[model samples]
Target: MGLRIPVKLKHNDKEVEVNALLNTGFETDEPVVALPLTIASQLNLTPGEKRFYLGPGALVGEVYLAGEVTITVKVGESERSIKAYAVIEPREEEIILSDRAIAELGIVVDLKHMKWWLV
Candidate 1:
């Protein structure tokens, strides 16, 4: 297990709390949050006109842009909310937070201890 933290996502007046993976390798200049189709549906998000092909190494399939959502990350007494582009992945099973998202959330990851904390 890596740095998985509880996060609350809100959009279209709908909200859901989930454990999101803090993927340092998911590099992006803009704040992005990748969610499974089920989670996107839960937040009442619909795929937009924009789509992109993404994968760990090679292109696996296409993912759709689901607009933006407010992501609230809380650890202990530290909490923050930021707008992030939501990407819906049909093949994804877990929520993956991009590097930008982690930075915006002020999370400090300790890989050695397999722990994370808000800074």
Candidate 2:
């Protein structure tokens, strides 16, 4: 298992704080944050472009990047805006913060203590 932390997401005037797992498996240039359909709906996001995602064990799935927006995430004492690819999927249990997000947020994963902290 990977490190997970509580993150705050903001879009426009709407905001929601949820638990997000640092997804080490995701490799991409931009930060991608997977949100549930409910949360995405709350943010009033619309699908823009269709995209495909390949997960562990070759779990291939479809996603959309149509709702391109700048979302803010609160790390420790600072907040950073990231251009995130939103995934409005139905069955996801937790939000996923991709590697790019991890680095941008300066999140240090301390596996030995099973903890994560911002630098």
Candidate 3:
């Protein structure tokens, strides 16, 4: 279920880092991560889990946690990291790099024209 991206969350103020796996299949798909409510509240997340609305009356709840961290991802000769929410998919137990990791590893996504861009 955690078939998405891997993000690294770093907090300069807290001096801590949390590498999290992100999945877009969550019900709410709010770009939030999987974490307890107690932790989520501290990050100023919504009340309880988020509710997702699909159809006219379809609704589903999602699990999310809020934590301040930075997302490190390598692009070229230098390393690139972005400030983002380190979210995970609930019911997902392990963390692994999806196709997204290839990008961070300095591999080209467009193999046709950009095959020589690997660094």
Give the winner by lDDT: 1
Clashes of each: 0, 2, 6
lDDT of 1 at 102: 91
Stretch of 10 with least lDDT, candidate 2: 66-75
Global local distance difference test of model 3: 0.39
* lDDT of model 1 at position 13: 89
Q: Please give the TM-score that candidate 3 achieves against the real structure.
A: 0.38
For model 3, the run of ten residues with the poorest summed lDDT: 23-32
lDDT tens readout by residue for model 1, 1-119:
66788899999789999999999988889999999989999999987765765668785576788999999987667789999999997888999999999999888999999888788
lDDT of 2 by residue, 11-113 (tens): 7777877778888777768877877777787788766667777777979987666465455556556766666767666577677887887787777787778
TM-score of each: 0.91, 0.81, 0.38
Descending-TM-score candidate ranking: 1, 2, 3
Candidate 1 is scored at a TM of 0.91
Global lDDT scores for all candidate models: 0.89, 0.72, 0.39
**Candidate 3 residue-wise lDDT, 63-94, digit = tens:** 34344344455435556553444343354454
**RMSD from true fold, candidate 1:** 1.5
Write down the TM-score for model 2. Answer: 0.81
For model 1, give the 10-residue run with minimal summed lDDT: 48-57
Off by over 4 Å in 1: 54-56
